[model samples]
Target: MAEAVRHVQVIAAQCTAMGPLSQLEKAARELHDALTDPMLGGCQARTGEYPSLLIGDDLTPQDIDKAVDAVVRQAKADGAVLVLALLGHGFTPPQRTDLYFMVRNSTTQSLRSAVDVGRLITEAADEPGIDGVIAIVDTCHAAGGVPDAGRLAGGVRAGRSRLAILTAAAADQPARDMCLSLSLARTLKDGVPGAGPALYIDRTLAETLRDQVSGQVIGRAEYDQDPFPLEGLWLARNPSNIANAHADVVGPLGLQDLSQSVDMWRGPRRSPGRLTRSTLLELEKFISCGRVDDELDSASRAWVDDVVTALLEVFRTKEFLADVLAGSLTSDLLRSAGRLAGFPSRAEGTVPLRDLLEYAVLRAQPLDGAPWKGLARFVAALLHEAGISHVDPRLQEWARRLHLVTEVNDAFGEFAEARQRRALRLVVSLVGAWTEWPEEVDAWLLHGSADLPLHQRFPCEPGGAHGVAQAIGAAMMWARRELPHPELLEHVDIAAPAHLLARWYPEEEKVGRYLLGAKYSVIPRWSGRLDEAEDNAEINDAARKALKKMSSCAAAPVEWIDSDALLDRSALEYRLSTGQYDAAIGVDHSPDDLEEVLELLLPFAPIVLWPRSGTRPDQDQLRGLVQERWHELPDGLAAAYRHRWGAHQHCVACLGDIRTVWHDEGWLEFCRPFEYRVVTTPEEEA
Candidate 1:
């Protein structure tokens, strides 16, 4: 129902965690005064009761909710618009979606006693007989309230009032000051130069986003209201301006005609009246009340329901909403209608997902450019950013079949690109991959997409490089065929015993073409074996200490072991026992270096860089590269190897000279895929 908003009932809340209470209290007071007083406020003074103010260190979340409900009821009875402001610290709980306004005795771990912003919006919008509702929230995640508030716009509720929301948030992070609320109060008192007969919250929000309001903090506003042709419910009158604000050519600065002029006051920017998912699901209900539709049949309603279900799966998450509110959404993503571009438009505000579809179907707007894959594309992008990608190709096909109004990104193509972007390294180990250690050829099994290993037992002469290379090569080829693309296989890290790693394996794709080190990040690990070896519990304690030294900023610096000291194994072991080195870099390697220097260095030093035994190009270059690229760790070693590849372009065998070995016993235990052993009970066996 369209109601002419008269006076507004102001209800402002302030909750702070150990700070000066005066600033918050003053900001709320200025807002309330601007809404009630006539001269500076620009509104006629007419009120039966004073504005409600809920302020304190003693106020609980329950106190805030109860007070808001009471004020909303009073506003409904008086037929007045409600101006509700929430100012304080907002907390997003661990791994969960909801944004909670922290009050007395509130904690991040639990939110049973916190004031939910979405629930409060639902409360005000659902109240009957209220002329209008306007909410101003200033917190870290204030923009998160936009989608929920947009849902109640003339749909899904019998008591639908005109709803307008302007929620502000700091661009940097967790709001430290009351700049937003203070700026808002000051703006209401001192009206804009180009404003018309009335000043609405939309104009103020635009000012805030542009940083025209305050210089202390840069801000973004998530604004959405009922699609009014002219303006939203008036917050205050234009303080004192001409009957009509206009712009005329400045005769001194312009070369154009002197009489040329343009109207400065055109009112707030126009919106497409974007319909949200909540509105779409109950479009029939909206029609029965304020709107009418002759074309909305049973088939159409069923279609909308199915469409909403799919959209909800993609959009209904704290992660998605919060990310978008933080300006993560792009114009190309919402590129359904030509004019409908940005997430929250610089001029018109947010373009809800269902806006284009609603207009296309109901208003009979043209839908030629729209594609069905927009949602799929958006999901793929979101998943990629969050380090996730697990959408079924069939559901993507289903989206295409229904011909939903949005986009057309190839699911398989996108997934392939995402895998490459992730740069996932495959873990191909003889003992780890196989059910029965590495004895005979067995069937290959691939688990899902991405980092999961392929299992199979292969027959290879123990420590025979050629036979082992071929077995690993066969398994890799099988994995690429089963998965999306070969490029997704960034590199392979083989898990095997010291004997296998000691013998440099040749590339199976071409026998004697190049060595396995040409693969760059082809690392060797033995933690899997270490975990299975006797006295593993003792080994775990040493592993933790090694990890601590690597991660510590003040740990002993990396000291290179002298190649001449290779003959004195006792001296090397004694020097390492001093705890003066967190990492070990070898100048040169011999046939005996692996067991002598490496074995002693393993339990103490976490990072080890060495030249493979076959090639001895230059110890000086290896040492220089290690010194320059020590901080980058795994990636640095890969880069150094690539540089060496270029240096030894004339020699194919030397391309695989440098090898990097990273053994983290802590990480190895943490990522053990199967933690439980299968036991056959007697009753089950029978």
Candidate 2:
């Protein structure tokens, strides 16, 4: 028995066409052939009957709305993969130069205003089980085609989304219509679709089906009815059991026999094509579980070792070789290759590097750790293509060790608490390396710059500007490892991270700023006049007021205060620079707090120690005391501790201080930052 036929639908919108009329005619003809071709095997048997429509005129707002509504309704009911192709004239105004899709209605002679196509594509993503969608826009459209040209080719990115866009021009240039529409027609006629035949979805499907031949129904298996009018190519093929069931009967058939069958099937069959419900159920699985996954697994380390030797015997034979590669596949092959350089991890054994590198080239992650050398090199490739990087040794080493640091990082960053500690050690190790050896560490943070303002730079995510600053601080520390404190400070500035801390800490931004401004200014400091401090007594009084404010900030989750820890570190850096570390004492000393500040400020200071005693330990200790008091500390302070301290161990101790510390069956019964005197627990502490 041969494979059953299936149906598919397409909706092409040629909104902007600057190309010659011949080319548009050619594209239209090609689309028709693509839909009907039998030799090309393009059309699958669609369940619902709806003629594929190609709208070639400019679209107005009314047209756009109608199109969307119709498309949506059909999409909901038919549940067929719909492809819309746009080609036409378009231009962005000189004032607001961003290109938009130039849509027009059949009746409207003048062009309607441009609608941003990005929004449309985004909307399309929400449609369910739509399979794959391709948008081919050749116009002066902004997404990807050239500017002012009839075709633009640039917009659309690959992701979890099933939609793909191919632009005719770069963002800056107008799309080139030259011969594209005709070329597309000719391409479809010849049995291919993309950059070349190898890249064409139609060609790929042909190859997939040809490989499945067992000589039973050779020429009977065609994609569509004809080759001149292009349609969305939908492949229907025999299942493994059926194809192989009669294999013994057809096994002896060779290329010559297969070719003969192809010639015989060139004529129409006697049987009216009908798909069984069982066959439909199976076909559903096959299309959904396409060939991408097969290609990936075949190329995988685990599968390669198992199947390679056997496959080598059939490599030279087109029929066998094609069968080995055909079928609908998952996109995971690309994703996995992109992420790991195709290095497949296994519980059974290690994989070879050759396959891993091939995977890397396909996946676009740095192969062999080449990106860590410097920021310039790391970002150069990906800026052009998203989610691809070269292998950089240092970066690889860091990623490899992220697991260990994650644990402590979770407890400290106090972000989304309660998870396995993230790989904080790798970060620590990297910073240690950078502080210890600048020459050895060469890297650029491609996305976040350390120089940006704290508010602008730091997002709520842990990996935001704050993380980047910490990473830089670590790198600086590695560079200044052997230099004297003053010399090292001169070479590197802690201001970036420190200022972030000051800006966010509630007390530093509010009360602390108020008192400091009053004590130190003849006028507003930004207006530029400094007043001399009358005595240490006056400064001490100001410091105590600031301490009260700092205490308030330390009591809440660090996130509650809208400042960067880096700023606090920077302010502390100034104090250390002027021999005022003694004056700014009394703050938290949790593991999370210390590691965060150390990881944040260590490039500027060699030794950050916890205070033995002070009016305010969190205030005086600043960086150190925060590191020491890990378990009890809140969010931002906790993150600081993890970066500074290796890990948090031992247990939480509730000691009596000013206030009585009481526990109800191991439940904590006291607010933090305030002192406790009588310590009592109804149950044992962990």
lDDT per residue as tens, model 2, 530-590 = 0112332333334344333333221111110112323465564564445333212222333
Candidate 1 per-residue C-alpha lDDT over 1-686 given as tens digits, one digit per residue, 9 for 90 to 100: 11222334334444444344456777766776786554333221221112254556666877777667656654554345666777766776665445677676666666776788777876676666555667777766666554354546544554345666666553234554566677777776676766664566664545643475343333333333333212245566556442331111011101110111101111233322222345434643543353234244444444444344433333333234344335644333333121221111111111223332222222221355354344434444443443333444533444455453134245435555644543445555554322223543332333334354555555654434556666666666665676664445545566654444455442222323555555535556643433344444444455556565433221112444545556676766665565444344343455454744555655555455566766665544454444334434554455445666577544633424556556554334533432333434335976
Q: What's each prediction's TM-score? A: 0.33, 0.26
Give me the candidate number with maximum lDDT. Answer: 1
Instruction: Quote the RMSD, in angstroms, for model 1.
Output: 23.5
Report, for every candidate in turn, its global Cα lDDT versus the true structure.
0.47, 0.30
Q: List the RMSD of every prediction in angstroms.
A: 23.5, 25.6
Total backbone collisions, model 1: 3
Question: Once superposed on the true structure, which residue ranges of model 2 sit more than 4 Å away at CA?
Answer: 1-22, 35-51, 56-59, 76-79, 93-98, 103-112, 145-160, 176-178, 192-686
